[model samples]
Target: MMNIQKWLKHLSFASMAGMFLILVMGALVTKTESGRGCGDDWPLCNGKFVPAYTIESFIEYSHRFVVGVVGLILLATTIMVFLYSKRKDAKWYVGGAMLFTVLQAILGAMAVVWPQSSAVLALHFGFSLLSFAFTLLLYLVYTRFGGAMNKGDGTRLTSGVRWAVWGVLIYSYVVVYLGAFVRHTEAVGGCIGWPLCNGQVIPEMAGGTAIVFIHRVAAALLGLSILTLFLFIRAQASRDSAVYQAALYSLILVTLQILSGGFVTLAIGYDIYLLASLLHAMLVSFLFGVLCYLGIASVQTAERSSAKAYAASRLP
Candidate 1:
């Protein structure tokens, strides 16, 4: 029989991986414009239990099928975490993962049944991102509680680095949402040229082009912020290698994200662009998870420092 710890470990990993794949498949559904493949009938394809085997129906149904399976995995993970992890933080993180997963699933279903505005539909993707990030963190917290990974040195983050990590994280979400909005609104082709829209930095600020241009600008600022975060973490590399490595990983993801964005532009509306777009989604998701982990580490360090100072004060 598998030990409970081992069972939970495998479950957590499976849940996280499943969520990540769901994220990518969701992107595929959007890029392929297969949302309506089931023809306004959800949980069933066109009023039938089985889909008719058309390309659109197959993509859409496959996505739904995957979501159903992942949902079960998430349910199991949540139950196991509460059963095994008595830590307050562990419970909260796992609970949040379960909550957002359900919320995202509901939002996706609503859009399928009732055509929503672009803004509302865009939010559906945002929730998917949140669900995935939280689930990944759930796995991390689970591992830490089990004493599986090496606990990093007790190094407190300077206020500057701590704030930088958080700032970049929240800003990344805004940039991600903007990108989703571009896709939902069919504004991806608004900027015809790579980097610059229509060979102009400012492309008249009219129609879908304006939306695309603004997302590009926001993304540029996001890149700069992550670079600043990386520098701050690197400045204290000797103190805590763990935080530094997390920052380095964030840097790599953001760089790949930017490159993928450019490729997405060039390959817009083509089957090849689908791969680039999926990469873009996955990079941002993992980047957000890393930033969250760094933030949590900083808090843990601060708490430890406070305890040490209190003990020393009492020593006198």
Candidate 2:
């Protein structure tokens, strides 16, 4: 039984890493304009089992292959969780991964066979991000075992702090989607500068410029929101607590995310922008995952506190 559990842990970690790869490769496909590299084909690249020799076809086909393989691993991990694990939240994480994995694949297929609008294309990335987040959360669950709640050396979070954590998590997803929209719409050029749009605090709200500007404002707010949440969590929880550490990771990632946004702007019109773009996507993916774990830690801490209080009241 112990060996089986250990194997499950390894499998979950692999699935998590594979999902991360998919996210990076998906971003690569978009940045290189390789979405149509397979020429409107699904499951097969350019109507062949293996695509012809072309950079675009290779990227597109590789992404498809990785998604298919990782998806199967995720499915196996989910089935094992149901068969062997007893945690209720474990199911939620794996279930989310399965659901969004399917949705992301369908969206990718539709984009190829039907050529979706930019808004729809942006959703493809959002779905992929969610899938990656769930897989990451599942890995965290397996590695931590009895859950981070068991290490409750920290103080329970206030209702306000809990709300703030959940709120920021949801808002960060919105900011990510806006960033995806900017990519799909090719609106990066509209801004032309980081921390400023066309050399102004507020540029003309029209066309691609408007889209980029909105994403910028949204991202800036997300940074501020995360910073506020981190400080609040630190004040309430011990520095060594899971909740506090998660918040600290969140703060660091958001800071890097903001800096990467600036780096991307500076690298614009240069080939280096591709690397910068990938860095941006990678940071956001981890940031979202960390925030999800933080939410879980917050709820678990609250539940632990309530259990203790109830037990105390029952003491005679």
Candidate 3:
């Protein structure tokens, strides 16, 4: 049983890492404009299992290959999680990962089969990000709880803090979507400056400029919201609590994300922009995953408190 548990832990960690790799590779494909490199082919590159050599085709096909391989790993991990995990929430994490993985794949196939609008393309990235988050949540749960039904630390956060954390989580996703929209719409060049959009407090809300500016504003708000959440959680939770740590990581990632955005802006015309953009995507993906874990931890803490209260009331 101990061996099995160790194996499951390793597998889950691998799946989580693979999922993040897919996110980064997907961003790479988009940044390089290699989505159609296979000439509208799916499951095959230009009617061949092995695509001809070209930088664009190689990148697009490589992304597809990693997706297929990691997808199978995810399937195996999901099955093992359900079979071994004694907790309901553990199963839910794996199940959510499976669901989002399939959804993202379907959306990805559709994009390849037919040219999609920028909005639809952005949804593809959103789905992938969610799938990554679910996988990460699954891994974190397994490592923390060992797939057992252990009661969590009964540290109850204030209702206000709970709501604030959840609210920030939801808003962060909106900011993520807006960022994807800016990328898909090729609006990165519209902003033209860091900390300012087109050299003004407000740029003309026309064309790509508007899209980029809106995303900038949303991202800024997300940073402020995360900072507030970290402070609130710190006030409520101990240094060792899972939610406290998750909130800390989220705050750190958002700060780096903002700085990475500036790096991307400065690298706009340089070869390094591609790397900068991928780093930006990677930070946002991890930030979302940490936020999801924080939400789960908060709920567990609340449940533990509720259970304690009920038991106290029943004491004779």
Which prediction has the highest lDDT against the true structure? 2
My TM-score estimates for the predictions, one after another, are: 0.93, 0.96, 0.96
What stretches of model 2 exceed 4 Å from their correct place?
149-154
Stretches off by above 4 angstroms in model 3 are: 145-150
Worst 10 residues of 1 by lDDT: 144-153
Collision pairs in model 1: none
Worst 10 residues of 2 by lDDT: 145-154
**Which pairs clash in the backbone of model 2?**
none
Instruction: Compose the digit string of candidate 2's lDDT tens values, residues 101-135.
Output: 99999999999999699999999999999998888
Give the per-residue lDDT of model 1 (tens digit) for 1-316: 2587677778878988988988899988998899999998877899998978898999999999999999899888888888876556657777887888889889988998998999998888888888787777777765642221224456666777777777778888899899999989999889997877899978899999899999989988888888987887777755335677677888888888888889989987677888888888888788877877776766665566678889999995
